[model samples]
Target chain A: MKLMRLLCWIMVFCIDVHVKAEETHKEKCDFNRGNCVILAEDGRRVFRSDEILVMLAPRALLEIRNENTVQLVKGDFYIETEQPVKLQTPYAKIWCEGECKGLFSRTAVTLEVKSLDGNWRITRAGEKTVYVVPAGLQVSIGEVAENGQAQMEFPQSLPWVPTIKQWASLYPGKVSEFKPELEKFRQVWREAVEAVSVLHQTVATRAVASHEAEVEQARRQRLAQLREDQGLRNLFRDKNP
Target chain B: MPLILYMRLTSFLCFILVMMLGWMQLYSRAREIFNGTSEIKAEIGHLKSTTAHERIAMALEREQFLEFRQNVATLMPDVLKSKGLGEEGYPYRSLASSISRSEAELVRQTIAKTLFERAKDNFRQEKFPKAIHGFHQIIDHFGFTPYVADSYFLLAESHFKQNELEACTGVIQEMVELFPHHELTGFALVRLGRIYQVQNRNEEAIEIFKTVMRSFPQRDVAAQAKASLKGIDL
Candidate 1:
């Protein structure tokens, strides 16, 4: 037990050093978490966690500090990373492991995993069997022996589990006295939609402008061709005559 | 006199013939330029012009972009009626038409950011209840998104401020569970330990602080956890 504790201490020390080193190299770029940002490295990932635990070396190595990882313990997390990394759930030691680069989330009753790039597999603990999870497919890997099939439906939506939306009837999360005040953000939501729409419009406009410039250039070239043909004909008449 | 007049007529005829020759030469030069063989080579030096279909598509996109930008600009009133603050005016202006998926994602992310900031502002202003509500909304709407984690942490803080220990505990537990390797997890653990201490659950608090020391030895949270443990021991 002493030896194990010593090893754990050494590992934590090494990870701490590694985390400090990454502070200089990684920039968050386009990455974001909630309304704030934690790490700015690589800009391709987002990390959402309350704390670090588990057998993994460190969040820094996995680029989790910069949105490269999805911590689905509290809520769902979506991130995109160029670097290849594998995922292990809290029950990863007992359940499964696989490459991840997409959306991953969990509720009290179920864990869902989806990959956008390609297919990956999650193997059962201490078993030879592996479950292949294809890209764009969502699956809830029900307990270890549940035959690793990916399911499309979320548990919150199931008849038995009620969500905040269905809480008047009964829900999964603890019942709260205060509602989310969803109605309050209505105007901001509308503005958000409008902002996105406008941004798209700008892109389309630029594309059109580029195309128009090309057309004008083509017209000039055509006119030049016609003029050159006329010139050549006159020269030929003079020579033949 | 008749001999002199005949000489004048010959000179006039010679001048007319010279003028005709000059006219012929000028016409020939103009026609060569018009033939476009040399001009074509000169004009298309580097540019490989786009196809007709491509040009048409671009024109259509440009037209749509203009229309969309105009429409979005006029979309809403600058002032929004929020829950607590009625008819609050936003300072920024609106912009629109991207055709690519990546561009669309960028726009979506930008909007999420705007909403996230608004929620954060509520927290910074000491409006704990309103902030908690706002953060919850973000998590509910944008769960599994980059905003979810931030919302979770802030929501936990909001609950902590309101002295809602149970709710705070639940939020922190969720954060730690979801993000076992995140930096905030260390902070959450520390917070959890403090809460435990407040409740006089010394042993449980010690365990949580030890977990932080074992997991994140270099974090300030670890130091705080160690201090808490020492305080408990003394």
Candidate 2:
């Protein structure tokens, strides 16, 4: 019996650990209007995680599947990442890696991926073959074949890529050239995150403290009840004797 | 009899232990539910606070970008001259220079477009003050962009909505002076005429209406001007 009880407890512990391990980490929208639209008509919406940053052009729709995967419903996306990430569209799944900077766009009948600064591995939705796309190249997949796979075009050199100089000029004093200012912004972001974490910790501690107090009160009541029941049993025993 | 009593006592103790365990299980379930509720409430509170913070942060970013753009715009003329490029040569330059003039123009256009859209949204939401501010920002800092024409008209409209007739007239006159050939200039003239009529200056209103009718003949602005004239029995 003791062995069985011990096995049962061990199984419970293992299951608990397995459930925690299986819990998926979801990505949250960091910046955008409530419906994932840009705040301004011409502005882009930004979503960030620890590993990747995604910018959605106006009218683009993106859904987060997990920490490293996103589903692009339609429209254009500019993605930058320091880790491998997956972009899912109706036509294909694009796996990007190693400081990836890419543009992805999808429409009802087609999908396009451009690797501006990194590498991409694309597999059609129903196909087994994967195609590699290198930096400064683009791939377009259009129309499904008889075997239910989209036909991917040969990777070709991208027609145009925005230069670093152009990007810096577009957002002057905010990016590339403005290291100190960016650092200041990052500091603010860190402080805000720390403040929120502290607030969460305080709230959790208060809740746990209140729960402990309630449990202690209930335990005391149960002990009193048990004592009274014991006294009644003793009186009954004496009477019977 | 003694052995039977011992078994009875042992069974009773077993029953007590099971009952205690069941009670503990029930208490733990209740505690879980309580903790879950508290966690959900805390999450909701955190989300609300974070959303507000995000909005403020975004607003600050926009403000910073706008200030940067204004500073860049102010320095652009001198920079162009120093590089031996005409002021009108802005969009023809390459990135070889410290500041790419074409990129600067693109940035200006983007800021102007964004400001115009935001002002339009504010106008639709009936937030005249914020709308006026945005339109003014576009006109003051991004005057070279195409949105300037629309911004001028909207600024006048915002002032009109706020019943600031004098300010409305001033903006309309400025729009007409700056963009005499612009389609919105005709509209601005007609609006100015209407403002004159509202101030009971019928003669001046008629003169403005006649100007609109003469300059914008066979257009929507002429029709609007004619309607205003007929309203005053001209």
Top TM-score: which candidate number? 1
Off by over 4 Å in 1: A1-241, B1-100
Report lDDT (Cα) of residue A142, candidate 2.
Answer: 64
TM-score of each: 0.31, 0.30
Task: Return model 2's CA RMSD, one decimal.
Answer: 36.2
Q: Candidate 2 residues B112-194, lDDT tens each?
A: 89889999999999999999999989888887788888999988999999999899989988987898878888988889988
Look at candidate 2 and tell me the lDDT of residue B32: 70
Which regions of candidate 2 are displaced past 4 Å?
Answer: A1-241, B1-99
Poorest stretch of ten by lDDT in candidate 2 chain B: B92-101
Q: What overall lDDT goes with each candidate model?
A: 0.53, 0.68
Write model 1 residue lDDT over B89-206, tens digit each, in one string: 2222111113222334666777677778988998899988788878887777666459878888888888988899999999998988898877777887888898999999999999
